[model samples]
Structures are given as C-alpha cells and as structure tokens.
Target chain A: MNRTFRNMLLTLCTISLMAGLSWADTLKVGVQAPITGSYANEGQGIENGVRLLASQINAAGGVLGKQIEVIPCDDQGTAMAAAICAKDLVNKGVSMVIGSYTSTCAQAAQKTYFNAGVIQTSDGTADSLTENGYWTFLRNSFPNSAEGEFAANYMVNVKKYKRIVVLSDFSTYADGLGNATEAAIKKLGGNVVSRDKIKADSQNFTPVLTNVKSKNPDVIFFAGYYSDGGQLRAQQMALGIKADFIGGDANDNPDFIKLAGSAAEGAFIINVPSPDVLPYPIAKSFIADYQKTYGEMPPSIWGLMNIDGMRAIIHAMEQNKSFDTKKAVDYLHNLQTPIDGITGPIAFAKDGNRKGGAYVVKKIQADGTYFNEYVQ
Target chain B: MDIFLQQLANGLTIGSMFALVALGYTMVYGVMKLINFAHGDMVAASAFVGLTIYTQIMGQAASLAAVIVIFLLTAAVMACIGIILERVAYRPLREAPRLSAVVSALGASLVIQNGIMLIWGPRMKIFPELVPQVYWDFGGVVISLIQVIILALSLFLMVSLYLFVEKTRMGAAIRASSIDQDAARLMGINVNSIIMIIFIIGSSLGAVGGLFIGLYYRGITFNMGWQYGLYAFIAAIIGGIGNIPGAMLGGMLLGLFNAFIAGYISSTWADAFTFILLILILIVRPTGLLGERVAEKV
Candidate 1:
C-alpha cells in the first residue's frame, strides 16, 4: 500500500512540472537605470515611470494575458555597468529592455542588446546612437543636435537675437549641443561672438564671465546640466552682463530657478514638453495615477517618454499575440500609425529615432515658475 | 589694461580663497609632519554645515546677522570635529609608521565625504544668498563688492593667524612643539594640547574658506572638497608645506597664475598649465620660494 501511494505522488509531480513548462504566462522586461550614484535622481525617476507603466498595464488585464515582470538592474550611470546589466538581462531571457537616461550608458549597452537580439528602447539623445545601424536599438527621446538647432532657430528667428555666445561643459551631450548650436546659428546668419568651455566641477566662472562680458554678446547659449547653468546665470547677473541666458533640456529642472534666483527670470529652456503641458486625457490620467502611487508629480516629463516606450512594446506584443522580440522590433520599425504618447504621438523614423517627439520652449517666470512659450 | 585689471581682481579674489584653505594644510603639516589628506574634506563638510544652518535651522533668511551666526557656528562645529578626528584617528597612530597614519587619513577622508553624502544626498545645493550682490565697476574693469570683502577678510584672517602663531605664549608652545615634540614635552609644554590647538585653528580657517566658497560660487556639492583640497595642497607645497606665510603666498601666486591663464589662454588649460608651472618651479627650487634650509637635528 505504501509503495502504491509513493508512485502515485511521483506521477502527479511529473505532470505538474510538464504543465509549468508548457503554460509559462509571464513576460520579463528589464529596467536598466542608474538607480544609485551621481545620476541616482534621474535613474529613480525613470525607474518610477517604468514601474508605473507596468502596474497600469497589469491592472487592465495585462498584454497578451501574460503578467508583466520587471527585472530592475542598476546601471550606476556608467557604460561598463550598463553593458553588464544588458548581458545579465539577456541571460535572464528578458524579451525587451528599457532604460538609461544618459547617452554614455545607452551607447555602451547598444552592441550588447543588438548582439543578443533584444529590443532596447533608451532615452539617450546622442545622434551617433542611432547612426550605428543597430536594428534592435530605438531611442525614445529627441537628439541633442536637434535640440541645439531648435534653440539656435528660436533665438535667431523668433527672439531675433543676433550676437550669441556659446558655453559648454564639454561632456558628450553638452559639446554636441554647443557645437551644433554654434553651427546652426552661423548657418542662419547670426553672429557667434565667442565660444568657451568650462570644466565639470568648476564653481567659479568670474574670469570666464569677465571674458564673455568683454565680447558683449546679445544672447549667451549655455549647453550643460542645470547646476552650472544656474551658477552661470547668477554670476552673469552679478557681473552685470545683460545677455539673455538660454539652454537645453539639462536646464529644465526646477532647481535651476532656485539656484539662479532672480537671475533665472526670462531665461529660456528647450526640452521635451513637460507633463504639465500635456492636455490629453491619457496624459492627465497617467499623471494622476502616478502621483497617487508615488506621492509626487512625475520627476520630469521624461517619465512620459518612458511610459510611451513601454506602451509601444506592449502594444506591439498585443498585436503580435505573443512575446516575440523580433515582431516587436518589426512593429516599431514598420509602424503605419503613431503610438499615442503622453508627450505626443510617438512614431519611429527609418533610423528608429522617434519622429513626433517635440521640443517645448519654456521661459522662467519672474516668480520662479515655468510657462510654456512655444512647442514644436 | 582694463582686461588686465579685471583679471587681476579675479586672481586676487580666487587667490584669497586658496590661501585660506592652504593655511590649514600648512599648519597641520607643520605640527604633525603628517599630510592630513582629510583637510580638504573638512572644508567641504563646513560648507554643508553652513548650508544646513542657513536652510534648515535659520529658515533661509538672507540677513547679514544670520550669515555671521552661521559662520561662527560652522567654525565651532568644524573645530570640534577636527579635535575628535585627531584624537581618534591620528593620535592612536602617532607612534605608528607614518604610512599607516597617511592611510588612516585617506580612510578618514572617505568616511567624512561619504558620511556627508549619506546625510545630504548627492545633489548640488545652491548656497543661500545672504549678502546682497553689488558690483563695483571701475571704468572697464568690473569687480564685485564681494570680491573686495573676500580679499579684505582673507588678509585680516591670515594676519591674525600670523600674530597668534608669533606673539602669544600658546603660539610659542605650538612653535616649540613643532620644532621638537620630545624636547617640548620634557620642557613641560602640553604637546597634545598644542597639537589640538593647531587642528582647531587650521579647521577654523578651513571653515571660513568653505563659507566664502559657498558665497562666491552660490553652489556647493559633496565632492567639492576634492578639487579645492587638491588645489590648496598644491598651494601649500608650492609655498613650502610647513611654512604658514609661504602657504598664503603660494595660494595667491597660484590664484594669479590661474586667472591670467584663464583670461589670456583657455579656461581648459588653466588647471593643466598651473600644474605644469608648479613642476617647473619645483625643479628650479626644490625647497620652495620661502622654505627654510634646516639641517637634520638628529
């Protein structure tokens, strides 16, 4: 009797194991972000956005009726760590990966994702990221060069500034935008009075500002992160230079106005349209839900981009009726209609760069508030 | 000529800050013969302490009285921290091999830096604008009122420090201890207290430098100490590491060189060129410009 009972238990266990193998109904998505280190705030913001998207998707019966699982891997804001994260996620058999705010980390993971045949939707904005012809790599954010051109055009054509001086931190992102803006300004028949580069950790800009004052430019275009941008704005005012300060997405943070204080007033910033500017019900609902869950407004409008990226992949999976990376890549590449993004309608160009991504021109108000001045 | 004057003002302003921080390095090395690598980190800590006092405690009021209070409180807190660090980290290793003490100093620097990072997080904070900004334009050469105050304050502090080191009984005790620790102890001098006082004085000067940096830059970061510390160390070495006045001179000269290079050449080359000039100076005069020629007493 004991032998018969043991054999029956073994038979039941074998059948359950076979069922588990055949009926796997979970999709693993990898989240690569610098969840710690210098860019931890940005990484946390991106991670929160991705998690919000996943929860919303899961609550509404999920994609293809399979539960979505997020495998978080902190890239620590470095390329080497990003590459390792991509490899680790690939080894975990994740269908796709989303991540990485900085271009350096995204570019580092490019070949790894490409070789592993995983679709990587990154927010990195370097133009060279897409120029490499990686079929699996698609960027959700607009290129820095595009932002640079937009800034130059806005200053010269719209604001009607003729004499422009450029300052950059010489990081890949800053230099790219600075050089591109300089080129575009000259292309549009505007004068570039002087160009200067500041080191990353420099706190004092008096000598540089003094030199800039000597040139007497009408508009000073700064292309660095908000920390230095704010410092420069304050120093410019302190030195009595009357040039208008303008910068790229790096200066979009609220901290810019606080640091620059009264000096930040009238300064223009070009970045992706913030969530506050999004008028669509979809965007509104996402914001409300995100705030309800996370206890804050989305860290930045880039949170919307991350949501749209996740939606694009989930929508593709739903269309394909299976979790296939190849089909998702194909769907993103040969898209006939635009995917509704909180930022705007998201569609990929031939190079897998998002086509409908728009730059919003924002001006800092006198009372340290931002108002949308223009959108393109 | 206007540009030269403007650069000169810039050099003097920056030089004063460097000199203030270099004094700390010079004093500690003078007494202990140990490079307190953590000296720079102390400056950074003082900045954060001053920031916390302004924002959290003082409710972000931009008054001169608040600034004075914060400066004094920050200096006092930093002095206590310096004393504790010396007692715990340096004093135990006083008799150990100098390499062990050096390693301990590096470890102490990491602890302080990371400890501050953990408390404040890694965001760059804008220092409160207590002093109203006013520029003083002399024809084409523009200088800020803050620049004048910074220069005056730095010179006053350096002079006061020089007097304290040269004139008082405690000053004589400190000088005696630095010259011959065992002999000073045998002659009834409280060698430990003298060293403690040295740390206190050095750290207080560092606190002042940190406060000025926050005011001048209007922004401070957790890792700012590393850059400022490196520059101050170079300044101390260039002025003769153990010589107090040498440190002040070294800092001012380094600041002048930096400003001139940035004004005339490229800002990118300012740091590289400064180091290159230092190497050249060292090659020419191994004992530095004001370094004394003291024979081995042993």
Candidate 2:
C-alpha cells in the first residue's frame, strides 16, 4: 500500500476505537446521598452497598449486555441539595437513581425525577412518600406506619407495657413514626402517658426523660436517628429512668450500640433482617464478601436494602431489555415474584413502597450486640 | 417538684459544658475584641484528638491515667492549633479592617470544620466511654458520675480562671491590653505574648468542654462545632459579651431555661424559646445582663 493509504487506514482504526470508547452504551445509575454532612455515614453506607452490588452485576457480564456505571451525587443531606442533585442527575441522562436517606429529601427529589421521567428508589420509609402519585418514585424500605404499628404491638402485647411515652425528633419521618406508634398503642388499650418532640441535635435528654419518669411510663418509644436515640438511652440511664427505650429503623446502626454502651442493653429496635441473620446463601455470601471488601459488616440494614433495591431495578431492566423509564416502572410495580434481597424477600406494592418486607424486633443483648427477638 | 429537681440537675450538667466553651469565646473577645468563630471547631478538633488517642493509640486498656493523658494531649495539641490559627488565619488580618478580621474568623471556622470532615470522612464517631458508670440517686432525681465530674471540673476551672484574671501578672497584662493595646505595649507588656497566652487558655478550656461532651454523649460529629459554638456564642452575648463572670452566669441561666421549657412546655420549642429569650434580652438591655454601656469599661 502507498504511505498515504497506510496512514488513512491507521486513522480509520483509531476512529473506530474512539467511537467504541465514547459510545460504549453504558447504563448510568445516579446515586444520591448526603455524602458530606452529618448524615454522611448513612449516605456513604448506602453508596457502598449500591457500588458493591453494581460491581457484582458487572462481574456477572453486566446488565442487558451494558456495563453498569454508578455515579454518586452528594446531596449534603438537605432537601434543597437533594432537589439539585436530582436535577443534575436527570440532566446527566442517567437511566435510574438510588437515593436519599431521609424521606424529606426523597420527597424533594420526587418532583424533579418525576418530571424528567427517570426512575428513582429510596430507602426512606415515610408513608406519604408513595402517596405522592409519582410513577417514577419507589421506596424499597417499609413504611413508617408499618414499623410503628409493629413496635406498638410489641410493646403492648409482648411486653404488656400499659403506659408509654412516645418521643420523636420532630422531623417528618420521626414525627410520622411517633404518631403512628402512639395511635397504635392507644388503639390497643395502652395508655400513651406523654408525647414529646425533641430536636434532632439535642445533646441533653434529661428534661424529656424527667417528664417521662414523672409519667412513670412502662416503656419509652423514641423515633429518631441513632445519634438522638443512643444519647437518649444514655441519659435515661443516667437519670435512673428504667423504662425500656425502643426506636424505629434509624436505631439500626452500630453507632447506637457504641454511643449508648451499657445503656443499649435491653433496648429494642425495630429493624429488618440484617444480612447476618438472612438464611439465604446469597445473603450469607454477600455479608462475607462485604466484610472482605469493606473490612466490616454493613452499617445498617438500609445498606443491604439498597443492594436489593438496585438488584431489583437491574433485574427489571434485564427482563424488559430496555432502559425506558415507563417500562422499568411498570416492571418494578408489577414484580410478580419477590426479589431475594440480602435482607429478605422484597416485593413492592402498587404504590411503590416495599410490600411483604419482613421486620424483626431485635433486642440489644448484654454482649453489646443485637439479637433478633422475633420476626414479624 | 421531683421533675423540677431533675430538670435543674440536667440543666447544670449541660450548663457546665456551655460555660466552658463560653469562656473561650469571651476571653478571645476580651483580649482581641474579635469574635473567634473557630472557637467551637477547636472543641470538635480536640475531641477527635482525644478520641484518636483513647481508641486507636491507647487501645482497650484505657484507664483513668489514660483518660488524663488523653485530656492533656488534646488540650496541648489544641492549644498549639489555637496558636497556629491565630498566627496564620487571624494575626495578619488583625491590622486589617475589623470586618475583615471577623470574615477571617468565619473563614477559619469553615476551614476547620471541612478540614475535619476531609480527615474523618464526615462520619459520626463514638467517643470511648472513659468515665465509669455510677449514678447518685436522690429519690426520683438522679445524677451520674460523669455529671458530677463535669460540674466539679467546670467550677474548679472557672474559679481558677477568675483568680488568674484578677491576681496574676499575665492576667493584668491581658486586662491592660484589652483596655489599650498601645498603652500596654508602651508599658513594657508584650501584648503579642499576652494574646498568645489568652489563646492558649481559651483553646484549652474549649478542649476540656469538648472532651466532656464526647464522654457524656459518647458521640461526636465533625459539624458539632457549629451547634455547640452557636450556643456558646449565645451564652456569651447573654452574659454580657466579653465579661467572663457574665458568660458563666449566662450559660447557667440559659441551660436552666432550656431545661425548664423542654420539661414543662415542649422539647421542640426549647431552641425557639432560647432565641426568643435572646431577642427579649437584647430588646430589654442591649448591653446584656453584665455588659457595660460606657466605652471605658473594656
């Protein structure tokens, strides 16, 4: 061949390679999390779980023959930031999104993602989240109402606590759970002696605990994050309030045990089946792999749920052979078989909240670790 | 009555932490006449230093000696940080416009908070429980060993601070410099060294408060500086801005008020009530409870 012809051939080859590099048909999944603020731990934990699952899916020959790319958008754990993150992700043309540790953030992002016709799933469990009539939004976590009802029944039926004090951090999520729990307890003929709302960053729980002590409640139900819950437990012990402290999903973190220390003993937390307790080989191996990869157990069950939620989304995409938002939404909403999640079997209701998601009432044992008392 | 007693005890416990942190704010304001916004971040930084020493360096064998060692190490290290912060972030801006110095303090606050976030990865850490679990029961009102220690230590430090400010030569220099920097310098007082000494004392006190909070709550987040810092600033303002005794008084009063409101009214309204009180106080007496209206008071 002539020198000019040879050079042209080389240029053509380079063009093809560049085309393959630039337009490789990768599926982009946006991960929205508060990765730079006080709630960064929870958001980071969720991102880790999703990233790990994405790697696993890619290793298994990718989803729908396309390489999975998980892009994280830090929302700083604020509703405003979350909305901006949602808009940015939609602008980036991501196929799907996993997000938002708090319900308020999820709700904030819902309008943006819904308007853009992008699929988004959250671990936040606020009941009204699914009621927003957004086809694009789904929650893999169970509702706050469910968890609250479960907790109330446990307190009234199992422990037979007649007088209870319900306390929340006054966030939408915490207040919803606290209200539901109080209503449930009252419905079951249990007296809600007092109800109080505390600030999310409250350092002192003495006044609230003192008031509860005066009420002589048999149990104190706290609906808030581990920071508040753990400190509340410690302060309650300090103030000689012997009432057992029970809390919602936010209590399902290692930080709670660490902060509460000896006070965490006998405290009950409503949680999903942690990966360690999942009887499935898939879950057991996931836990083992997580430990090997991350050097610790998953921080909370929400981490495992994020993995399963992403898995379900990917499975739906594979079944439909399309990244079209409407198709994926329909597939997820009509998921006939439950996805075998690391936590447990996860199915979705028509409203997009997780259906048949098993909750477990776990007690913090004397060994400073949680043990599943019973599955609900 | 039992509830009132319990709330009071709780208020005092939290009040001691506020007073300790308020001393840092007031002292810096007294000497430099500049609000050190980074004062609260120093608490967080010191707590993390103490936490690192206790958990990573000292390991599981931490005892009373370990606690004391960690406390001293944190205080010393944070004092050094205060010196460096003053030298790098504040001293150059010292001769600049007063607003520039204030802006620099705010910038320093952001840098410290975000720097901590970068180092610690924005995760909340559980401080090692150094104080043993023991409670003194008074019928329905109980107090823990940690609370007692916090109260006693704060009282000792406040008393020492009072005596040092009133009696010591360094304290005299600090007071003189606060009155007139040029006059103090002309009087053979090394104003720069006195300023550094003030930073040292303030930073150490802030560290002690931070360490106590970490032990009491057993949780520390990087941004905790802002929360505690805001409260300390409020207390300082309420007690009469740069007045040391006023800061102590403001801290106790604020704590008691917070506890009472939360106990009697609503915990959700506690913070709102606090701000309302601040607004009311400002409206009623802009000079604060102990602040002087005349310029010669400084």
Candidate 3:
C-alpha cells in the first residue's frame, strides 16, 4: 500500500511538471476589468470579448506561434482595486493587458504597466489617460475632449439650444468629461447656465434638479455612467422639468433605458456608433461570433473597442514578427497602414490616444431603440 | 418663493423615508444598548425581497390591495431574517464584551451586503411603478401622487409604532426590559421574548422603509444600504438614540438641512455640511435633543 501511494505521488509531480512546461510556450494576456461591482456588466463584457478573441486566435494557430492564454483580474471598478490588479497581473508575468472599461481604473493601473514594460490598452476615454507619455499605455477609444467638442457642436449648431446645464458625478471620468463639455460649450459662445456636481449612487438628485429647474435651462447634459444617469433622467421627468435631456457617452447602455422607463423616450445620447450600428463587415461578423459564443450581444461599444485594441496589438506583433513588447509598441506608434477594427480603422497618435473619433447623436425612440438623429 | 416651496416638499419626501429607517436603529439600541450595524443592510435585503415579491404579484395594472400584500409579505420575511441574525450573530455575544457584539454586527453587515451582491449580480434593479404618475401642482410646487402616498403611509406606521410602545401591556414589558433586564426577569416578564419582539418590530419598520425607497427612487442597488443606512443612523443619533419621536424630528431636520444646502449652496458641500452639523450637535447636546440623561443602574 505504501509503495503504491509513493508511486501515485511521483505521477502527480510529473504531470504538474509537464503542465508547467507547456505554460511557458503560451502567450499570456491579462484582462483587468470591473468583473463584479457596480460596473460588472461592462467589465464582464470586456472579459468575454478578450477571452473569445483569445480562443479564436488559438484556434487559428495562435499569436507569434504560441497558444494565447488570457488571465483576467477583476478590478471591481475602483482605482484601488485596479492598482492591486495591475500588481497581480504584472506578478503573473503577462506580456500585455486589454481591459479596465472605466478611465479611472485604467489610469490607476497605467503607471504599474508602464514600469513593467507591458503593453496595455483600454476603452477608458478620460483625457488624462495618455497625457503622461506612458509608452506602455494606449487608449482604445477616443478621448473625452473629442466627444466634448462633438457634443458642444451638436448642441450649439445642429440642435441650436440655449441655456445648457452640464451635470456630472464625482468620478474622475465623468467630472473630466463634464469640464471638457462645459469648456467646449463656452468656446462656441453657447450659454451654459450651470455646472453642477452630484454624489454618485446617492439615489437622490431632486435637490440638485430643483436648483437646476430654477435656472430654466433648455438643455440638461448629464455626463455620468448609466447607473446614475438613468436615475437622473427618470427623476428629471418626474419633477416635470421641461429641458431636453442629453446623456454623455457613458450613459449609452441598455440598462439606461430600462432604468429610465418610459422617460427614456425622446432623450438623446452622444457617443460613438453603437455596436449594432457599426457599418463595417468585420464588425458585423465579430459581433455575430461574439453573440454565438456568449449567447448575448456585447454590452456596449466599449467591449468591442477593447477587442479591437487586442486585435491591434496582435496585428502590430505580427507585423514586427516578434513577441517583444518594445518592438510592437514602436510598430504601433508609427503604423504605415491603419488596422481595420470592429469600431473603425484603428490608429493611434504620437500621444497614444486613438486618432479620428466619429460620434453620433442618437435619440431614444418610443420603443426603447436609439435613432441616429445626427452624425459627426 | 416657489423654489423654496418645492425644496421644502422634496425635503419632506426624503425625510419620511429616513424617519422610517431611523426607527429600526432607535428601537434595537433602546433594548440591547447594542447598535445593530446590520440594520442598513437588512433594509437593502428586504428591498430586494420586496422587489421579487412585487414583480410576482404586479400585473399589467397595479392595485392598492396588491401593494399592501407586497409590503406585508416583505416585512414578514425580513422579520424572520432579523430574528435569525439576532440568534446567530448577537445572541451568542450577549454575555460577551459589548464591543464584541458591535464587531459581530459589523461582520453580519458585510456578509449580508456581499450575499445580496452575489444574488442580485451587482446590477441596479428598477422598481416597477405601482401607482399612476399623477402630479399635483401647488402653485409651482409639484407633488406627485407617489410622494403623498409615501408620506401618508410613513406617518401611519410611525403613529402605530408610537401607540403600540406607549399604550399596550407588551409596551410596558418592553420598557421594563430595556431599563433593567434582570428586574424585568424577576418581575416575571420574559426578557428574551421582549428582545425578540423588539427585533420583529424594528425589522418590519425597516422593511417598509425599504419598500418605500424602492417605490420612490425607482432604482435600487446592493450596496445602497451603506449610504441610506449612514444617513438613517445619523437621523437616529440626532433625535436621541433611544427615542422614537426624536428620530422623526431628526430625520426631517437633516432632510431639510440637506435640501437647503444642495439648493442654496452647492451639492458638493452638502455631505460635508451634514458631518459638521453632526459634530456640532454631539458637542452641544451629547445625549441628543430628545435623549434624557439616564443614570447607569447599579
């Protein structure tokens, strides 16, 4: 009996050794997202998109002749958790990371990835994300400055509304977007009556709305995530506020309509083309493939954008014919040809911010569908 | 003037909910002298439970009968949970150090909060509108039908609780146990039963508050308890930790203070102003406005 037990132990040791050896031949990609917190839906969508892409690449003979292994770390949509996840992923020896849907999380993990010389890409649109000259970090989505300009133009030129009220929560992303939009509005000689800040998840905005109501603004622009955005819209409608409600990029989620109920109708949301509205054939096919694998469509355009980031990084690596992050980073910085992405032609500027942002002003229809009212 | 009236109406609507939640804290602290830190999470859990029951019973059209049934069923289920929490977390530490029970209460709060998050999947659930959206404009101060219903129901509950605690034979026993547990036991009153009764009343009131919030706010999340619970805790303290009427007054004052601060000043400073007010009150009154200076029993 003792001899048999010893033999079993020896077999387990050999199996584990073989497993460890095979891991060395695989390309490890880390995903840092808010997998289980207030932003769980977006975080889970990013994880699903990256994992699906990894499996597809593996099935097609992998990247750099190595099987792709995806490692996911849940940042829970907080800066502290994102920093911890950055350390964890770095310790796990990941060559690249595609993740962290929110800008604050991405910014928190930015320095860590830069120090470790790991290529990191995310859908966070906060303007400060790429401002620090982090060679290791690339923004998958357009910065808030771009969207802010588009929103200002739409409000000033297209819709021609006066007395705009810019509202935002205390998050780094929302507050920055609010500032950008407010500044852009002023630049265009548009009248911004009030710039208000709200405590996120307070579930009570009546006081602020009451104050805004007195201003008699024609437009109320809320730059916050869908969680608070929907509530703000619903409450605004309930209070009989006559202003036209326009939500910023972060408010473009199905849950927003769900939370807003019937009040969602006639509300406008400004963002890049939604996942279903993308005109690219590759976008359509990848979305179809994602739906087939995950049994649900991608949560929003953010997830597909992150997947595009992953595809861009892999394309750069294939062009350089190497897994060295430094070479891939250099290739990505000055790509002679833009890579076709699920969003659009993916290209990065010298500052690591995505180049050429296209935005649309989509109004919510009675049936809870978004109608593209104007495009820029 | 119209804006002032509207702000006042908003303050009262929010204060009604705070007052309801504050009662649970005051009642539990009154009996055991142990603050049930789990009270806020209990309110959140009850709201989720209420949501489930509400969805099941609510048809294409909502009825007054169905709404009452939802409230009662949620309260009953939450009362059972409160009893279980007391048994598992507090009862064991009853004879232990007071700080141990407080720590245990905090632990229970975490467990319930995380459990709700796991069950509900961290997404905010929208509460179905049970009443028709009818707004009554009072010379620019618009009041929704739902807001009126909330105020009326909360007032009813608070009055019922006050009467039950002041006028009934069980009320006397409860007061006795709270004042001196050993004396009450020697007087042939079952102190354990009184404690159990306190949990039931406190949990039920909190459950109703949960329902009211879900109906009023229309958006509920797993960790929502911490925010509302903290406000309600402050409300309880401001009113006097062991007094019922104190909670009601405290909640209203805090609500008014918050509304005025957010309106006249800035929303960013409202929370900071609330904390400052709390600190000032603590320094000035110490025992709270309604709290009496009771000598420690030898």
For this target, which candidate reaches the highest lDDT against the unseen true structure? 3
Candidate 1 CAPRI level: acceptable
lDDT, candidate 2, equals: 0.86
Clashing pairs in 3: none
lDDT of each: 0.85, 0.86, 0.90
lDDT of 3 by residue, B1-298 (tens): 9889988988988998899999999988988999999999999998999888877655534788888888899999999999999999999899999999999999999999999998887767888777767888777788899889988988998998889889999998988887888899999999888888899998998998999888887788888899888999999999999888899888888888898999899889999999999999989888887998877679
Index of the highest-TM-score prediction: 3
lDDT of 1 at B152: 95
lDDT of 1 by residue, A1-376 (tens): 9999999999999988865753486777888987765556667778888888888788888777777888889887677899899899888777788887777788888888899888888877778889999988878888887887888889889989878899988666678788888898889898899989987558777778889988988988998877678888888887778888887787777667877876788998889877776878889988988889889887676646766777888888888886778888788888998877787888888787988556878889998878889878
Clashing pairs in 1: none
Compute the DockQ of candidate 1: 0.40
TM-score between candidate 3 and the true structure:
0.95
lDDT tens digits by residue: candidate 2, A215-327: 88878889988878888898888888878888788888888888888888999998877667779888899888888898988878777777777888888888898877799
DockQ of all models, two decimals each: 0.40, 0.70, 0.63
By DockQ, who's the top model here?
2
Tens digit of per-residue lDDT, candidate 2, span B104-191: 9999999999888888768888886788899988877798889898999999999999999999988899889988899999999998
Least well predicted 10-residue stretch by lDDT in candidate 3 chain A: A15-24
